[model samples]
Target chain A: MAPLGDNTNIAEEVMVAEAEKRPVSTIVIIIAMQTEALPLVAKFQLTEDLDSVFPKGVPWVRYHGLYKDLHINIIWPGKDGVLGVDSVGTISASLVTYASIQALQPDLIINAGTAGGFKAKGASIGDVFLACNVAFHDRRIPIPVFDQYGICAKQTFPTPNLLKEVQLKVGKLSTGDSLDMSPHDEAAIIANDATVKDMEGAAVAYVADLLSVPAIFIKAVTDIVDGDKPTAEEFLQNLVAVTAALDQSVTQIVDFISGKSISEL
Target chain B: MAPLGDNTNIAEEVMVAEAEKRPVSTIVIIIAMQTEALPLVAKFQLTEDLDSVFPKGVPWVRYHGLYKDLHINIIWPGKDGVLGVDSVGTISASLVTYASIQALQPDLIINAGTAGGFKAKGASIGDVFLACNVAFHDRRIPIPVFDQYGICAKQTFPTPNLLKEVQLKVGKLSTGDSLDMSPHDEAAIIANDATVKDMEGAAVAYVADLLSVPAIFIKAVTDIVDGDKPTAEEFLQNLVAVTAALDQSVTQIVDFISGKSISEL
Candidate 1:
């Protein structure tokens, strides 16, 4: 009885020690566009790594610093050296997210970006959203069993505390590589019950799931998908303002996440 | 003058030594389906790593062995543990390809799979093609410069010698996560001048280019995209026969690559 009591006491002490450590310490934010990254970089005061933490020749950029008690790293797939365009698609997002996870091994990943909102789903321009679920809108495999695999729907890490703390809209987010939705994409998106759409959310979610990393998506509305205006025109028109909204929401989120456990969130 | 001559001789000896090492010794073959991977695995006499070379909980399978003088690894994203369905889309393809490349640094990547061939481009059932160019048909980002980036068109490594040695067809290949082509995808495919379409070729190409590894694509026609028959029905009917053709073609190609360098090909 004495030895058993000592072992029990030792186990309790180990449990107490584990509980004392902060569950969420390091955070990595994956942003696809430089325009979307700049505001957050300024707000977080993240310094660019001039030596480049990523592989050579690729235009992937990393900015790092500490926010409060949390270590923060924001990574973006930089502009194409030849085409001079921001690398904004699922392919680049997946590659960068995979590389970031492999390199940083952060406790949490936050995919913050701009997306097109659906007015039918009660979304408006410049509204920030915490995505509850994410899936691809364009991968349409028509085979029997493979049809569902094409969608690859995934749920983001639950943050009920964060949701209650912040007054942000919550919705299902659909992802596709296309900026403009085709008829097929519309049908798929409707089936997905998605309120917001972006190019990289589901891809990032897929990579995160593959690596067993918990991820949260915060998307700001840049355009109304079902609206009358052209997608490209509306996106460009609202990018700057929407990015500001996203930056503010992300800042609040990171502040809340600091010194808190994943279970607490 | 004597010292200069000796230095020249040493330089020539170093060049000869470099040339003597087999340049194309390690090869990775990425197949998306089990039915497509079985034949190649059997032909190469590869043993399945039941212990699993991939990360735990992922269904990615690796079959590896020595084929003649080359080290060949055939990787397939296996069936979903819960859903019991083959993981078959760009998301799974990209993640598995990235993981495979990181784990096994290979000299070449050969994406071998079944594809929907276009009758308008003179593709017939069971026709094997070595893709000359690879691009995406469904990633339709409509922004000004991003319109081109969405397609992400890339050229495959040239194999003029192999082309001369083999009698397989050669054409442009377009990739999308969708098995069924949308109208927008069709338009993009036409613009890509694609003769064949699959779900993973361009994704594999993207990762390969990011890692600076040379890649080649081998596709066998399983269905005619523009034909009168239904895609699913036709694809099901031809899958077995097409796999045979793909196996034969891949075997011949591997045999050809056994003793040659990338420069020689």
Candidate 2:
């Protein structure tokens, strides 16, 4: 009876210590549009908009909510089509991602979105890719010192061992700020061994890497880079499906992150 | 006397026809800060906001004015650090530049700003540089197909003959979307033979190239890359002088663009 009482005290102490330990509390999901982010927002049960938490009246639009013991923020860098061809893309994505990181100090950032895939590389519509690496395909720097414009230094390596738990393609993702990539550009991207092309992944990864934070790009193949089936029609047609797949990928990631300890991640 | 009358009539017709031709009516100058743009804005006497001209309540900020029969538009991407490190440098500049191009359909875009210089490459404080070509030094795209991030295709070759009219060093200007460059990065830049570095030049050039519009970058050396003094201190100390030089360069460019026909340029 006396030994049993002592054992109960030790068990209570351990339980209290575990309760005091904090898990990863903040998570930032960077998506270009409401549609892309909607599924994750819904899946995470994120309902609150912490707009009041930010300073009153700034053009920088931001949203926040709490999910499964984590704070979630969703921001649109700038509006779509307020600019032109490059409107859907912006350096503001990097800026916004950086700002969100600084403010929240997120443990991990998931840049979830859709991308144009290289059909020849076996990227099919509705297929989700977790970026093992990300590069800039359209950045043609003319200097002789470097061979390509892709910033391979910032290649976002996803936790492959952990990623195997999720069923998805893991490969190189190439990002460019513009969408009108020519066939020649497609050849360059393919030559680089990139399977996916996105507008904001590398930019997001670049900032996160600078800050020494881990970021993963979870993208769904919406259109093929050099596929012959009229890019505009294909992209528009597959937009919903890709976004749906993106939501599923983000959910899997969230579940993985939430279930594991930071040390494991 | 009758022959003389006929000659005079022909001269009048030719003058009217030339005026009707309207050489280069629109010029877009994309600058990051209001201070950098102030001199040109003042020099050109740009007094209109043109905010009303855009669809009301859009995030895209713009300034417009009619100067010597040329429409001048200047934009400030985002205020310095509402976002961290990559705040001021944005791909939004490209998007906005493209939008401005589409709206104004400018014949020429002059990306005027201050840059960190390469002293060994013969760059000094207050020295102006006209970008013969622009590349991205930070883009390490580990790929085999493309040669450089430098947009050699849109090489802004100074009318060497016309550039002699204005005294400024002309060379390749390298650009990246970040301010941080280590000694190793600096060495890479030097090896690439890039004499100057800035954030938005390559992006602006990329967009302009896509639209097939001619673009040029004229930058003033504000600080030496990897120089002895702290970059913030050096850049701040030289801000006034660099802006002054930038203003002078813009004046020279304005004079050239204004005086010569587009065909000559």
Q: Residue B233 in candidate 2 has what lDDT? A: 62
DockQ winner: 1
In candidate 1, what are the lDDT values of residues B91-207, reduced to their tens digit?
A: 778878777878887878899999999999999999999999999998887777787777888788888989999879999999998888888989999999999999999989877
State candidate 1's DockQ. 0.37
All models: lDDT? 0.85, 0.64
True contacts kept of each: 0.61, 0.03
TM-score of 1: 0.91
Give the lDDT of residue A211 in candidate 1. Answer: 65
| Count of backbone clashes, every candidate in sequence | 0, 14
Q: Write the per-residue lDDT of candidate 2 for residues A71-117, one digit (tens) a residue.
A: 77766543322121112343546656656766677777878888888
How would you encode candidate 2's per-residue C-alpha lDDT over B38-138 as one tens digit per residue?
Answer: 77777887764754433221234567777676777776553322121112444556656655765677767888898889788888888898888776655
